[model samples]
Target chain A: MAVIGVALVRLRDLFGVVMLSGLFTLTAASLYVVMDAVDVAFTEAAVGAGIATVLMLETLALTTGREKVTRRRSLAPFLMVVVTGAVLIYGTLDMPRYGDPGAPIHQHVAPRYIEESGREVGVPNIVTSVLASYRGYDTLGEVTVIFTATAGVLALIGRSRRTRRRKGSQTTGGDQDAR
Target chain B: MRGNIILRVASKLLIPCILLFALYVQFHGDFGPGGGFQAGVIFGSAFILYALIVNIESARRAVPAVVSRVALALGLLLYAGVGVAGMFLGGRYLNYSVLAEVPTTGQHLGITLIELGVGITVAAAMITVFYVFAGEER
Candidate 1:
């Protein structure tokens, strides 16, 4: 995965960069499976590795495959990235160790969910019970967010106009930049 | 891509299985490690694969853009409607205890319906995103 990330940064071809990022997501999905978060793995594999890659490839088809070379180097963006990375790494130092039973998370409402979810929701998978029932309002919010995304996309560049103007001369020469 | 017989045949064979697995994940979520979100993405990707292998026009014809647009709203409505139904039945918003004769049964029914709603909306949203991206002609 680290190698893929390095390759992604080194490759100037937008196509190769997209493929490498997809590979990175696939690797992360496998890591999630190894950590016993199969539900997360499923989502990462399907959304991150699958649909995102395809959408990015389609975007690439509409633009140039090669990234433009910038004559001037920008140090501010690089410094900002390094500083953010450092801060994130420093922040994780205070986090509880992975799967620590005495962690604050385990001492909270998680115990009740783990113990009583089966009786309360009557489902074998506690994750599903929690997501669909216990956190039903959250899921509803998530669904609304997705709906909003679709609406935004539709408003921006959805239905094609070419379908309606079928009889026009086909020499418009790519002026369909809806914006 | 149309000239690549291997890619064409393999995708034809794989797409159905992907769709079937998506349905399995949706219905069997309560017993396994999958659910509406994962199932929806998987389902959307099946159609996306078809679009990638064939062409965007035919894929749109197979599943019209209007259908997905409507589904996008319908899914959210289904989820919110369930919540309203709970309120009407004398429970708090999104509370499933009053959805049926028994609390646990109500919970089960509520979860399944809401999950279905999530799946439908998610699948529609993904397909819509793909269509919007691919519809732009170069």
Candidate 2:
């Protein structure tokens, strides 16, 4: 499945690439849902399927359809992947079973959020209370990140109209001289 | 594109429901697994759908670029203002218990205001992102 996904991403067609990316996001969201992380799944669906796919399609619109050939060797990426995979495997050796009742995560600060957050925050959604209230500074930083990205997008793609206007004025000058 | 009946009809029916659901999720998040982030995404998705079905220019006309920028800034200000309010009431930064004279329940009121701020910022940001991306096609 991974190989097929990679192949789809490598396909020359821009639409195909966007579709493949959506598929990859859906698969990741499914995994999250299966792991009982419904909130994470919801976010992955929204950001991955909804926003990222649209952004990629928009990017393709601003560029040539053809994929450029890379001359760089693959050894660095390959070694990095291997090392990361090894570390992930090593870390998983001592991990608790999926949905285990005794998992440390369930026994810790998480439970406090689940149990007492409603009374303290008057919000039923513990995730929101935690994200916006308990850790509001982090959420503020996240909003800043989004704000920066919005500015960057505007800077990059928002210049086309000015260039077009300049060309239009130049053509008008030529027409005036001809008359 | 303006004459596409299918897209126009579908979006008309879907957009309202999406916005309503976004609001429901925003307020009902305490019991469920949703909050500002999820609600913002849903709200943005509705606008994105509108942009997709209708013309991008028309969508822009409906939601001007300047309005989105203001919405983004306003959300951040609302959030910071709540925290500052808390500080003035003699608590630490963002310490919700100081927001009210009542000792026990002030934290709850502060949290609600903060969540509102998050929801606003997130929704505006998401819509702005969609607008920037959708605008590229033209």
Candidate 3:
């Protein structure tokens, strides 16, 4: 994954970058499976490795595949990234170890959910019960957010009757649709 | 792409399986590690594969823009309606215990319905976003 990240940063070809990123996501999904998080792995595999790659490729088709060369060498952004990484790493120092049984989360409401969810929800998969039932409001919020995002995309680029009239004319591009 | 017999035949074989697996994920989420979100993406990708292999116009014809647009709203309405239904059933918003004679049964029914709603919305959203992006041209 680290090697892929380096390659992604170095590769000027957007197509190769997209492919490598897909590979990286696939690797992450496999790792999630190894960690016994099959639900997350399924999502990463479907969304990250599958649809995201297709979407990026479609975006590439609309734009240029080769990234433009920039001669400017400003180190401020790089320094900022390094500083932010350091701060994030420092933040993780206080976090519990991976899968720690005595972690705060394990001692919190999770215990009640695990112990009582079967009786309360009668679902074999605790994750589903929690997501669809216990966290119903959160899921609703998430759906609303997705709906809003799709609406924004529709408003911006969705084909309208006015735009339909100008179909097959590549020179007009997307700007004419704003009118 | 038009003349690639291998691509054409292979996709025809795989698309149905992809769609079937998506439905399995959607309905089998309770006993498995899949759910509406994953199922929805997988479902959308099947049509997306069809679009990528064939053409956008044919894909649009297969799933018209108006249909998807309505589905996008309908799914959300279904979810929200479920919540409102709970309120009307002498329970709090999104409370499923009162949805049926048996509390667990109600929970089960509510979960299934809400998951279905989520799956529909997500699938429509994915398809709509793709249609919009793929509609663009240089």
Give me the TM-scores for chain A across all models, comma-separated.
Answer: 0.90, 0.76, 0.90
Taking all chains together, the TM-score of candidate 2 against the true structure is: 0.84
Best prediction by DockQ = 3
- Model 1 TM: 0.93
lDDT tens string, model 2, A131-158? Answer: 8677878977877776677777667654
lDDT of 2 by residue, B42-135 (tens): 8877877888788777777887877876887787788788889888878888778778776336766776676667677777887777776665
Each model's total of backbone clashes: 0, 4, 0
Stretch of 10 with least lDDT, candidate 3 chain B: B129-138
Best by TM-score: 3
DockQ list for all candidates: 0.88, 0.55, 0.90
TM-score for candidate 3:
0.95
Worst 10 residues of 1 chain A by lDDT: A170-179
Tell me the tens digit of each residue's lDDT in model 3 across B1-138: 888889999999999999999999999999999988998899999999999898889999999878888999998999999999999999999988889999999999999999889999999999999988887766
Binned by DockQ into CAPRI classes (incorrect, acceptable, medium, high), candidate 2 is medium
Rank the models by lDDT, top first: 3, 1, 2
